[model samples]
Target: LDRLFARHEALRSVFVAPQAKPRVEILPPDAGLPVSEHDLRQRADTEAALSDLCHEEERTPFDLARGPLIRGRLVRMSDEEHVFLLTQHHIISDGWSMGVLVRELGSLYRAFVAGQDDPLPPLAVQYPDYAAWQRQWLSGERLQKQAQYWREALSGVPSMLALPTDRARPAQQSFAGASVPVVIDVDLTRDLKRRSRQHGTTLFMTVLAAWAAVLSRLSGQNDLVIGVPSANRGRREIEELIGFFVNTLALRVDLSGEPSVSELLERTRRTTLAAQEHQDLPFEQVVEIVRPPRALDHTPLFQVMLAWENHAGPSFDLPGLSVEAADGLDQVK
Candidate 1:
C-alpha cells in the first residue's frame, strides 16, 4: 500500500483554495494511508456486518483540503478469508484509474510473494504532469476549434428530456440513487453481438442506439441528447497513470421521422464518432460555450447520462484465493 501511494502522487494530493479556483497540493512522503484492521470471524452474520461497515465507510465524507482522500480497511472473516476495502474520492481518481490500480496491485503482490524486487517500472509522468499538459494543449486556437464544434452540435438542444416521473422534481438536484441490475439472457446477448458485427459497429454503439430509442418512447420526445463518459486516455503516457481523466460527451440522438432500426444505428454511429473526434474539450467548457439555460432542479447540457462499462474491467489475479465480488459493498451512494 505504501508503494502504491508512492507510485501515484494523486494518492497523497489534496485540493485547496476557493472551489472555483482549486489547486492541488501534493503532500510529503510521510503522508500515508491508515489501513484499519477488523476481525469479523466472531460475528455470526459476517457478510451482513461487512456490508454495513462498507456502507458506513462510503457515507463518511473526505476532507479535500486537509489531506489524503483515500481510505483502506482490512477485514478478516476466517483464517484464510479476508477482504480489503478501498474508498477514494473522484477528485484524484476515476473508473479507469481504479482498473490500473487493481492491476498493478496484483502484479506487486505476486512479485512480493516470490521474494522479488518491485517489477513495475517507474511511471514516466505523474498526475500533475498530465494536468499541466492538458492545460497547455487545450488553449487558444485548439480550444476555440473544439468549442466551436460543440457550439454547432448542441445549438437549439432541448433544455431537458421530458422523462415521466411519478413525483415532482425537487428544487435542488441530488446524487442519491440506487442501481438495479437488469440481466439480458444469453440468446439476446449473442444476437446483439451478431447484429453489431453485421452493422460494422461496436456493441456500445448498438446498445446506445437502442437506449436512445427507449428514452424516446418514455419521454415522448424524438430529439434527445444523452451524456456519455469517455476515458480521455488517448495519449499512451496517461493510460497507465492513476488520475481523473474522464470526460463527458453530449450525443445528440435524433429519432425524428420514425427512422428504421438500421438507420437509427447508422446515425448513432456517426454521432459517436464525431463526438469522439472533439472529446478533448471538457464538458464544463462545452456547457459554457453552448450557454444552456441552467436550473437548480437539474444539470446543464444533458440530464440523462449513459455510462457504458465497455472498457476492460478490473483484473485481480491473486495467488491462492477464490476471488468473487462481494455484493452491496461495491455500491457507492
Candidate 2:
C-alpha cells in the first residue's frame, strides 16, 4: 500500500485542486505551428500535450516528493483551434475519472474564455479515500463470497486468449499490438439502446453481450472472456473526484448458444451488479485472486475489450467556441 501511494501523486494528495484545470489561450488556427519547431508529428500531439502539462504548473518541494506527476495539457494548435490532450498515469486516472476530468476542464475553459471566474467545487474526497474504503470493505467474509464465485465461474478455463500476435515470445517482457478499426452507425446505435431498454438491462451489458457473440463467431470457441473497466463510482462522494478510481475487471462470458441475448444479458446483469457491489476492490487484488500464469508472448486471461462509448464530459465555450469530435476520434480500434 505504501509503495503504490509513493509512486502516485494523487494517491498521496488528500484531494485534487478544485481550480487545477489546465488552460491554453488560442489566438487562432490560421497561424500554423511548425512541426519541426515543436519536433512532433500530428500523431505525437497527445504526447506533447502531456509533456507540456507536466512542467506548466509550479513544481514545489511537495510536488517533487510526489515525483514527476502531471496528467493534463492544453495546446494551442492554431489561431481558431486549440486542442487539449491529457495522459494521466493509470495510478491516477481510471476510465471513470476521465469523465470527471473532462467536465471540470470544460467548465474551467469556458469560464476563462468568457473572462469569468470558475466556481469549480472542491473535491469532497480523493483517490486515496476511495482506496482506503475499498481495502476496508473487500475483506473477510465478503471477499470469500467473491472468491467462490470467481473460482466456479473460471474453473477449467484456459489461460490463453489466442489473439494473433506478431513475433515469438522473448525472455524480456514487452507488449505491442495493432488493431483493426470498426464503427457502429448512429441508427444502429439507437437500436442498441432500444434493445437494452427492452431487456431492462443497461446499455453497457447489452453492448458487451453483442461483442461476446462476435468473438464467439470469430474464434469458433464457446467459452469467451472479456475485460471491462469498472467505473467504481457508486459512492456519491467520489463521483465528482478525478483520478484512477477506475480498475479493469475480467468478466468471463459463455456464448455456447444456450442463452439468448436477453438471457445472456440477465446473467451479465447479475454478474455486473455483483461486481459493482464489490468494485472497491482494486484490480491489483483481483490479479491475485485469479492467478493465471503471466506471459509475454500470449495475451492475459482476457484479451478482447467491450467498450461502450467515450465520456464527452462537460464542454467549454469561447466567444465562437464549439466542440465536435475530430474527423476520426471515435474510430474504434
Candidate 3:
C-alpha cells in the first residue's frame, strides 16, 4: 500500500479551493496510510457484520480539501480469513483505475513476498501530468472545434426526459439512490454479443441502443438523451496511470418512426462513433456549450445514465491468501 502511494501521486494529492482557483496538493511520501484494522473473530454473525462495515465505509464522505481521499480497512474474520475494503473519492479515480490498482498491488505483494526488489517499471507519466496535458492540448481552436460539434448536436435538446416514476420528483435532486442487479443469462448474453457483431457494433453500442428503446417506450418520448461514461484514456501512456479520466457523453437517442432493430443499431453505431471522435472535450465543457435549461430538480442534459463497464474484473492472488469479491459490494457503485 505504501509503495502504491509512492508510485501514484494521485494517492497523495488533495484538492484545495475546489470552487475557486482549484489546485491539487501532493503530500509527502512519508505520510502514513489511512488503513484501519478490525478484529471480528469473536462475532457470531460475521456476514451481517461484514455487510454493515462495507456500507459504513462506502457512506462515509471524504474531505477533499483536508487531505487523503482514499481509505482502507482490514477486517479479521477468523484465524485465516480476512476482508479488505478500499474506498476512494471519484475525483481521484475511476473504473479503469481499479484494474491497474489491483494488478500493481498484486505484483508488489508477490515481489515483496519473494524478497525481490520492486519489479514494476517506473510510471512514465503521472496523473497530474495528464491533467496538465489536457489543459495545454485541449484548448483554443481544438476546444472550439469540439465545442461547435456539441452545440450543433445538442441544439434545442429537451431539458429532461419524461421518465415515469411511482413517486413525484423531489424539489431538489439528491445523490441518494439504490441499484438492483439485472442478470443476463448465458444464452441471452451470447445472443446479444452475436447480434452486436451482426450489426457491426460493439456490445456496449448494442446494449445502449436497446436501453434507449426501453426508456423511449416507458417514457412515451421518441427523443431522449442518455448519459454514458467514456474512459478518456486514449493515450497509451495514461492507460497504466491511476486517476479520474472518465468523461460522460450525452448520447442523443432518436427513436422516431418506430425504426426496426437493425436500423436502430446502425443509427446507434454512427452516433456512438461520432461521440467517441469528439469525446476528448470533457463532459462539463460539453454541458456548458450545450447550455440546457438548469433546474434544481434534475441534471441539465440527461437523467438516465448507462454505464457499460466492459473492463476485465481484477483478480487477487496474494501469497497464501484467498481473495474474492464479496456479494452486494460493488466498487463502481
Candidate 4:
C-alpha cells in the first residue's frame, strides 16, 4: 500500500479540490471486514454496503478504492482455511495486476500469521516510475530505425485472423475468445523433445510454430497474425513491481506452401527476434503513430494470442482450498 500508488502520481493526485492527495488506507482496527467463504451471491449485497461506504466520502472519482472497487471479503469456513472474494475496478487492475495482487496478498497474510504487522520491503520503484522512464528512454535514432523496420515488415498486412464466428461481428467490435490446450502424452512428449534437441530450437519456438500452422489451416488464410505478450521490464528495479508492465508483439507468418515444421520454425525465430529487438514500444503508441486506417470492420492489428505463464511456485502445502477446472470457463481458439 505504501509504495503502490507512490509512483503513479495520477493514483496519488486528488480529484477533489478539498483533498490534496489520494492514498491507500487500511480499515480501522476492529473493522468488521465481512468475508464470504463460499461462492455466494454477495456481490450485490456487498456492493450495496460499499456504495454506502462511498457516500460517506467526498464526491471524488479517486475515492473509489475506499469504496468497493477491489472488494475482497474474507471467507472463513474453518480456522485453517480462509479465502477471499476479490473484485476490482477494471480501471486500476488489469489481468497482470490481478496475479500480482493475489501473490502479494498471500505474502501479507503469511506475515500476519507470523505476528508481523508490516510485511515486505518497499519496491525500488513502481509502475509510474517505469512509465516515466519509458516515455523518455524509447526515443532517438535507434527507436526510429527499429520502428522503420516494423513499418516495412508490416506494410499491407491484413489485421484480422479470420476465425470463423457464430454470428456476424457487432458494430462495436466486441469479441469473445476461448483457448484449449492439448497436452502431449508422455511418449509423444519424449519424442518431441528429442526432435527439438536435434533441430536446436527451444520448446517454445517449436510449439509456437505448430500453433501457427494449426491457425493457418483453420482460417484458410495464407497469412497468420498472432500476438504474444512480452514482459517489457528489463530493468531490475521494476522486475517485481506490479502493473501492466507488458507489451504485445505481433507475429506474422506467410504459409504460402505446406512448409515443413522445421521451415516454419526458422521463420518464426526470425519473426520473434525482430519483435524482441524493437518491442520497447507499447501497442497503443504503435497504433497512434502508425495511423492505421480506422475501420469498424477491422481490428487495429493481430487476431490470435499465444501465451505461456508460470504462477504457482514449488506447488505444495496449500490447504483448505478446492480447485476445479470448469469446461464452460475454459474456451479454446
CA lDDT, every prediction?
0.88, 0.59, 0.89, 0.59
Candidate 2 residue lDDT tens string, 195-237: 9899888888888787777777767776867888766677788
| Candidate 4 wrong stretches, greater than 4 Å | 1-69, 75-83, 89-100, 117-119, 164-167, 176-181, 310-333
| Native-to-model Cα distance after best TM-score fit, residue 94 in candidate 3, in Å | 0.7
Q: How do the residues 133-229 of candidate 1 rate in per-residue lDDT, one tens digit apiece?
A: 9999999999889999999999999999999998998899897787798998999999999999988788999999999999999999999899999
Candidate achieving higher lDDT, 3 or 4:
3
TM-score of each: 0.92, 0.67, 0.93, 0.70
Superposed model 3: Cα runs more than 4 Å off: 18-20, 43-52, 331-333
lDDT of 4 by residue, 7-75 (tens): 233233222233766544433323332323343243546544434433432232334545323333443
Candidate 3 lDDT over residue span 1-333, tens digit each? 888988899888898885588889997887865889989999999988988888789779988888688889999999988888888888888889999999999999999999999989999999999999899999999988899988988898888899889999999988889878789999999999999989899999999999999999998998889999989889999999999999999899888999999999998898889998999998888888888899999998999999877767888878977778876677521
lDDT of 3 at 109: 94
- lDDT, residue 280, model 4: 85
Count clashes in each candidate, considering only residues at least 3 apart in sequence or on different chains.
Answer: 0, 12, 0, 7
Ranking by TM-score: 3, 1, 4, 2
**Residue 102 in model 4: shift from native, Å?**
3.9
